[model samples]
Target chain A: MASGILLIPGPIVISENVQKALGTPSVSHTSPEFVDLFASTLQKTRQLFQAGESAQPLIVAGSGTLGWDMAASNLIEPGAKVLVLSTGFFSDSFAECLQTYGAHVDKLTAPLGGVVPLSDIRKTLGGQKYEMIVITHVDTSTAVLSDVKSISEVVKNVSPDTLITVDGVCSIGCEEFAFDAWGIDYALSASQKAIGCPPGLSISVLSSRAIEVALNRKSQSSFFASFKKWIPIMQNYEQSKAAYFATPAVQLVNALNVSIGEILEQGLEARIAKHHATSDWFKNKLRTEKGLKLVSSNQRVSAHGLTAVYVKKPAEAISALKKKGIIIAGGIHKDIKGEYIRVGHMGESACNDSLCHIQLCYEALSELEL
Target chain B: MASGILLIPGPIVISENVQKALGTPSVSHTSPEFVDLFASTLQKTRQLFQAGESAQPLIVAGSGTLGWDMAASNLIEPGAKVLVLSTGFFSDSFAECLQTYGAHVDKLTAPLGGVVPLSDIRKTLGGQKYEMIVITHVDTSTAVLSDVKSISEVVKNVSPDTLITVDGVCSIGCEEFAFDAWGIDYALSASQKAIGCPPGLSISVLSSRAIEVALNRKSQSSFFASFKKWIPIMQNYEQSKAAYFATPAVQLVNALNVSIGEILEQGLEARIAKHHATSDWFKNKLRTEKGLKLVSSNQRVSAHGLTAVYVKKPAEAISALKKKGIIIAGGIHKDIKGEYIRVGHMGESACNDSLCHIQLCYEALSELEL
Candidate 1:
């Protein structure tokens, strides 16, 4: 009964209306009701990506990690070399996924608490035989936002043929971006993050070029990962026909539909701006407080999601906070786990005040006498 | 709101209690409430599999088709030959998926509405090399259940080393089977089917040997499809921890938890018996009325699921029925769309009296002069 503030990054707290939408009477997956649901959800996802007529948005049933696999499988062919600009934990996973898909992945590694080195990637692209470039924007693990825009510019200048993709799982609605204007070929995010839906669906928006490559990539993409299966399903999706495959997670889709409705109705610009303001306020609060330090020392910080604050006896502080019904997350990735704690500022938690959660962490840690 | 019987195949209608469970106020995926929800749902799933003391169930976030990928990726190595006994639409999809996972697949194909020739599969096994075998019990696309017991017996005798896996997506709680007793290494089903939740989470039970294979075959299984990732995460899941590696579709998990409660309380045996009775009653009505003929003439019909009826102007009959507020379904993978209509009899619809649905269908079709 005592559900405290979800100040850890995604899956952030979902709204009450969204939760009510999920409880809507269970419907057949193939029933006319679900097609309308899928259609509406798909359209909302496309709007988030700013996808034009040439692009298509795909909703696959899985976690955000699966989105990386879907992107790798569709865009890259066996033996193709890809450049993975690793800013944090997520890009590392994306690199491993690329390797699994038979791509020779080259990682341009950056420190966990730092940004992608655009110049270094440019040099690598200048000399390498890579066919694709992948960037992770706002790696949820370390709270580091990569410079996807700068990296894209450099990569396009050096290797124009390279596919430009971003693992935007931790960013999206919370972050400001122009997908079409920036020429992003593929952008992937999950419902759990700034989208404010409980996780289970990974949404991917693909440019015309990415679709062309997917269609041309010799063999069919892994069946579950295939956009082709969803393409016609969405095209013919009307109230009367049965869904093409098995029924989808109808309740989750409904939750997403409601969340997206709130997002667009309020306007994305206002939402993203509010997230930045809330993050700025939350970070300022953490900064003014005693005993906590920002992991990323530079002013250039992740604008719209979680923040990492280094603390002494970090595990004890997290444990004590959990005991008080205010659960903050521990640092992720092999690089930063023991030294810092994460405070999520995304979705409902982003706009709503989590001052009590931040205050609870401080008070609990003080009791530990650390 | 005239909510008639949802006498359609999966995703069948879930109980009102289960549907209402989705209203349990949304929580962040990493919220303690959600972790407890996931852990509880999983325990219930394990009870269903009766996955002995040593075996485990890996709950995945995706369609049941993803199950074929999970089974193949974990068991079949690159170039690992596998045998598929294809009976219907889903079986072929499994074979195709195995092929994607780098297996040399040989299929013993059965005609539509038919089960594979067990003798032919034994013959194929004796001549071929395989690491695993794929079989489907009660193909949703055909309303036909293959003889899993007979097939497993033949595989055990002729090819003991090969793992036998069953796709019980349409059969799980609707019929009875012992994963261990039948020599099955893996059994997979979707929550949207007999378990009667909604679509998108896939539930699979692994034999102890299967888990060992999964752990040992890390070199082969794609990361997303690996049971290793699933095991540690689930093992650590508890009532108090926030489980947030990926977004988990929290509300759906809650709905499934509620569905599982109803299932266990209702008793698995009772549920399956209800399905059997309803399917029998429905089939009898179709046969005696001369309004339609069974498309699946095989003696071994799926005991507790659907009855695909052959009727003139099947599409018109289905459309007409839809207009009359009594919704049903049609046959799949038969190379033609309108020759047959599949009337589902599982989950909430399993206990349904066929008299009303039949009468309504007759009225609707007669009005259309079909």
Candidate 2:
């Protein structure tokens, strides 16, 4: 069972406490204790999002892609227009998912290393009415971060009726996101990423307006992804009543409860600041010492959880890091798939001092011939 | 952390080995070692299903209900005709899920404690062509076991083109089912049931014909549940290549691999027989020794994994058992919701004599003043 340090963008190195929670004996999904745990976990997720009283949180058994499916299936009816702000691979995938459920999607793509400009978004909004607008807060593929707050502001000013959804899969816990303040209608994330839990659950916070649209949808294209069926279930669980639409992943939900509790104990602001500082330090070290160029053109739009860096012989560099007991990822962006590598600096690896994962990555890269 | 013996139908008592696997260090989904594990696990799942080489096994991160959604979204196109053979609550729910995806569903429901007659199925098939026929192998609500093999045979004889889908969530590892021999097009189950793993993954085996239907569909009704999108990814993983459509539930998959390995070690036939023997012993003790009635009318129709016994005071009896360090489930079938209780005997609890789970249930029931 010997393993190297995990530096992938998600399925990050979980804390021992969280792992213990995952190992807890299986419990019935309808048990009173599990209902309380589930309810508390949902409430803590709201705290993580900094959502208001009108927002509802859902924890479903699936990966982050399920979160995208939830938004597409629940909020948008068939043939409804959706504006997808494509920052990278994930955003484009979101648009594709929307299309799968019969939505007429219009994607506004950004350049390879940037997000769409606010003026372009405004112009797009003015041209036609949209049912929803999706923005990826941090695209894991390219490590590009979008200005969600500014985009939310512009959308609210120009098209207030359009729902605002943020794909926070790679950003939620590590990055600063104010669900209430930014006026986001839905923020979807997974347990694996910066949440510091194992992969399994798709967590999302939905505003009351989003729930309203879901409830009033003319036709539902999916069953498992429908928010209307799940909202009451979630609400009932949060009220300490056992309700079932489906049997949840008991172990993963327990792990999430423990992990979110840890996040709150450390304070969300401090955790985000820690990620920001560690990311800056690691990116700077790579630049100054290894002469590696990041895929992100500027620091302003770079993700704080992971850095995608261009390097010669990306595969060789990754192998060398693996040899040094560190596991980093190769680039995933289609155009530069072989030209860069990615090093994640989130969760326990970013917040704790034991691993010094940043230094390990730098040392591993320096020893490599690339 | 002192817990009682879990006798509920699902999320049942997990083995120590599987729980230990759940606490394994998180690994990257694309890691070569994980890829090997994933491939081996998928192959082992085929062995569990007794499926042939042509059948494809998929392990997705979701509950059993997601399996229904996957079947509906992938196999049944919008406005397509489907025949739903309803045994109990879960079967009706499956019909609802199919209709949500725009399927024209015609449901033939069995009586409270009985299964749909094979003659009725044959008559229905003779009337019109159906795109698919869904059978819940063992309805969890009433513990009623449908004769899936006979049903499949009737479907094949009457309308060979119609796909035969079995909801094996409550029966897969405990019941005797031969996917290839029975001509089952799709068999779907969950991790937490008889598989002895925690809940999260939706496990299924699809015949080559089912795969073809999914690939050649004019349009995918759902994104995450799309077989066309996932087939390649699943195949690539089984080929030991790192492919990603969505981040997997790495730890749970690892746990499943371990649990399935244990099942193989015990031998599937032996495990099934053990469940059958223990179920017979428990049911006989409840009926002859305690004068309790079962919701399932006869032994031939009773599920091997769980028993639904009718009691005058179901809730009080369940609470009384709980107070004496036992956990059982109240009835869920609408006709006898408050009249029966369920006790499960499956997985390690059924196969091994160490826990004496069945004996414990009998002792607990004997202590109850029913």
Candidate 3:
């Protein structure tokens, strides 16, 4: 079967090494080798997140949305107030997820192409006490990047007790995020996206404060997403011991270990800089050379992993790109569903010189009637 | 890296074709090809379950335990009474999962290496009103297969309104289960068990009644595991349309499509029979030749996908098998936690004679000092 370039927001182009790792023969989840792999992966995740010794990492078999469930079910008790900083579709979904877990969610939504201002966040935190504040580091829908560092600072100043949770699905590997320095209580990501692996595992790092809140929850509302059941299992595995609460996605985790290894080998800071430079170059080409506009509207608010571009006849442009053996995404933000397209440049697509995904995408767009 | 044969209860030996599919280039989850693949996979899952038109199949990114969460969080409302027929560790875990969702649980537990009596179930149903009854078709820990057909019949006769939920994580593809004819409401399985795929996806078939229960629930208590959000997305995807809630695991789903296609090509009945034959052959060799006893005690109640043999020095036996490039599992049932070892014969390992996994396992066991 002929395969095309994947330029969508996630499940992006994976490195050959990572793909090979994914196809490695299935191993017993409790096998000593697998345990070692799991342990090393956890330790590397801490390094990637720049987390302190007080932080714990969890790798569960699920998509990125499971991360939201983990934070909601574990940290916030039923009826607790949560403040969601919404920039796009994913932020709204995160809010809905909190509500499903019986948390009273208040969303401070930004303009469609903008991030919530630090002033607004400070005012919101000053007015009421929130058990947690959720920030989508980069909302995939609009390719908007929130100011997590600044938001963390505001929350620390106004409400030191409010836990800060970040949806890092679209940004973790590509964007510059310091969990320890930023004082993020919980940051959740997935194996796909900038991680350069297939989608399956929900990866998260938790602060001691977050773990404490989870342990003191009045009652747990989930089973698979429950941190209580998984904490010991993760801790055991990272300690190179076999503990089974549930059978993990063995192959996916194997691929994750490989991909994360590649990321660390490339150096996290260097990887982030590469993503930023590639994204800036691609966005500049689209704006100046093709006379196109972006959903994020400005570089400061734009995500480094993906670029959402406004276009006329998005279906036609997407079809034209597909005919060129490339795949991009249409707008997902509800208010501007059909007016734009999203192209992701992360992981191997951004780092590898030979892929030339950016050039191909630009050529495809330039050739489009729109 | 030298890989050993996986004879554990799950994360079993997968086929080359399935592994190749796992490494297939990443594609947009919303792409037409992926949508068709997702739709066909769901349809094939229904066929695998022998589910009628009134049934809907769901594929979520998680392990088998996530299926338990789906059943509990979707079907049973908080404070509703649930009857769990427990045979081993997995069954007890399922009950714990249900209780985590606030279900009031009453467990009709079997003695170690036994199944709960149908008469006891009838008596229990006659005495109390249960919103749901959960049965582990084949509990992985003990290699005990519950008579799901008979249990479903008893439940139908005693209380027709009570939803019957079967934990088929270890049994679905290898055990003979007729979802529609047996009147099962919800049956949950995983990709890694008997399905000949790497672990990640929670595959479940839900009756229309169960879907209705999910739809009309007073409030959804889960964000990621919520059926209310996922049901429409599933329906849309199966209809060859792109609908987003959470990003589905694209590569794993692709692998699932291939594995399920292989199962369908082999014919579900033939596949189940192959597992049974292979299991019986392996068990006979252990019993007659090696003079080894099994945890299930009798063939009539034993699981076809795996055999749990009581052994002296399980750790040493496991180590011996591992040294011979074979991997088997140790006892997990609390009562016999250190008393036996589990050898799995399922999926491609059972159907493909070229693997020689059963023979290798037998040889490894025979070489071990009794």
Candidate 4:
């Protein structure tokens, strides 16, 4: 608790309970107790995505980058046609990930800080015989929230056989994602960003349709990404044993249980509204300062997560802030690198506690002589 | 320290220092301090691997299971011939892994509880062309240690172009490995096992030749398993700005560093011999018991780790042991399920210190009347 607050997008403010969970002694992944923890985490993870009956969850060993790979490799095999709806850098990376696995990736791009239109997605899908469609729920780099539900609708109407997947790495726990209702076959996420757990493992919620595709795959398309092993393990532990795979990062999983509990107990709708209000409050403070602007428009912007803004003398601004223990992320996207700064209001301590620091950041910015 | 002892193979034991490290608290992975810690761990890991300029240690998120995918997907493309040396459960998993990635896998299998013969491997390689060879260095299930030096020597004589990959999950920290000396293209292990840390991230060492083969492949791998993404990230991080992709499981990384320091300071050779002595002593004690015998041979065994014993009721034996707070792992491999029990003597308690509860276990087994 004495450590400085993490104001950056991810690996953000872990709660005291979450921190304590890390101190819990390690346990074997194959052990019944560990399986219980893993299964419990999965059950809760499904709740976050609002997954349906057939929505099986899988845990992979890496960053959200692994999620991009799972979506591409498991569903979009070589020569498979896929469409990626891009909002910013993350979407571009997801598309690149698809291409890496030999998927014919078609990017439906909008302007640098804008969301892709559903009509654009339909047009892209109409022209291509795509087997999978991927939409970024919220691209972290741009802080833009795409109309993924509408896009999924458009894809389903245009290409009925196409499997809809959402790159919800930054959105799932912080934003709204109804996987089944949105016709999402798979929704992928990581715990570091909004889930308030330290990063290491990647998580995915697979709809029954996605499970079918995995079951029918040409036999274990991936050793690490295989749902076959996880599914049986998950099933076998239905009553008592809860985890599948080797020992999980037990401490992180335990912490995630706490973070998720706190959020739900406080209520998801309240959390979402608080995030939106905080995003506005941060921008309001920034607007009072000279020559600073929010990159994302309110219409298609991320809520319950972040508000990225542009500022001149960026390096100096970033360094000055970090020197004070108020660290912010530097923009790395081609369009905004060195030209913008982002404030992450996503995790445990990201609400009322950060307001004081947000004011200090504004004061710090105004004091700077450009 | 108040927690009960872990007699399981992996997730074995955590020292007070490692526990303090895990409890040290979380930090932003991108922060300068964290980068310093991350880089420090990298340097320490390289020293542990005994890797030279031509080799580098790469880390990935997830368990040891993820290592097989990283090695195979990066090195083998479609129809890449692979020779798999199977000594036990974990070794055989490699063949399944290679075949999943479109490799023509030819497995050289030994008996369920025996080491693979060097001649069998040479004969398999002589009749066909294999681009790579997969060897599990120490399989905990069977407590069998493959003669890696002999296997690599035969591999070199028979097929010079073949890449030898060793799954060093249970051996790297407990036993010994020489990357450049053994001509091993890749060596994979997880933190939970002999390395003595929480289970989540993987520590794998890859050679320049392996990286070259990965780079030369026409089909680029998906993001998670792509060595290209990792090679650059790991190939040089002492000075690179981009040190980590995901928010690392910080506390666990700290725990790993502490465990490594303890292992290095104590000396691996000395520690391994201690493990051997303890296992030998435990087996001697168990042999004196009325109904217990080791499943693995005295000569072809893992000295730096656990000793699995075949029994009439393995689960009952383990369950009874756990009742006395003397835990041991139940056999999970299909061939030996419900027939063998494993007691690990690795990590923090790799000596007689780990045997404090051995007599207690014997007492429980004797009183159970089974």
Query: Candidate 4, which segments miss by more than 4 Å at Cα?
Result: A1-3, A242-244, A288-291, A352-360, B1-3, B244-247, B289-291, B351-370
lDDT of 1 by residue, A1-370 (tens): 2357666787677788887776665565666667777778888887887777677777777878888878777788877899888877778888988887778888888875787566788789999778888888887777777777787888779888899998888889888766777789999988888888877887888888888888767765366776656655555663245457545677778888999888888788888888888777666766675645677655585546888878776788777777777667887778667888887777776655544454454556556644
The single-chain TM-score for chain B of candidate 3 is 0.98
Across B1-370, the per-residue lDDT of candidate 4 in tens digits comes to 1236677787776776777787655576666676666677777787778787677787667788888888778888778899887878787777888887888988877787677777788888899888999999888768888888888999999998999999999888777677788899999999887787777778998888988887777776546777877777764455645554445666667777788887777776776676667666677767776556777776555445877778787778777777776667877677877888888877766643744654555566677643
The lDDT ranking, best first, is 2, 3, 4, 1
Alpha-carbon shift of residue B291 in model 3 (angstroms): 2.5
lDDT of 3: 0.90
- Which candidate tops DockQ? 2
Model 2 Cα shift for residue B146 (angstroms): 0.6
What's the true lDDT of residue B366 in model 2? 89
Off by over 4 Å in 3: none
Give the Å shift of residue A112 in candidate 3.
Answer: 1.5
* lDDT string, candidate 1, B246-338, tens digits: 556666677778877777788887877877777776677666756566656554655457777777777787767776666778777657456
Error of 3 at B192 (Å): 0.6
Candidate 4 docks at the CAPRI level of medium
RMSD (Å) of each candidate, 1 decimal: 3.0, 1.0, 1.2, 2.5
- For residues B1-370, could you state the per-residue lDDT of candidate 2 as single tens digits? 2247888999888889999999877999999899999999999999999997899999999999999998999997888899999989999999999999989999999998899998999999999999999999999999999999898889989999999999999999999999999999999999999999999999999999999999999988888888987889999999989999998899999999999999989999998998999999999999899998889989889999999998889899988988887889998888778888999888977888988888987987888787
Q: Evaluate residue A254 in candidate 2 and report its C-alpha lDDT on the 0 to 100 scale.
A: 93
TM-score of 2: 0.99
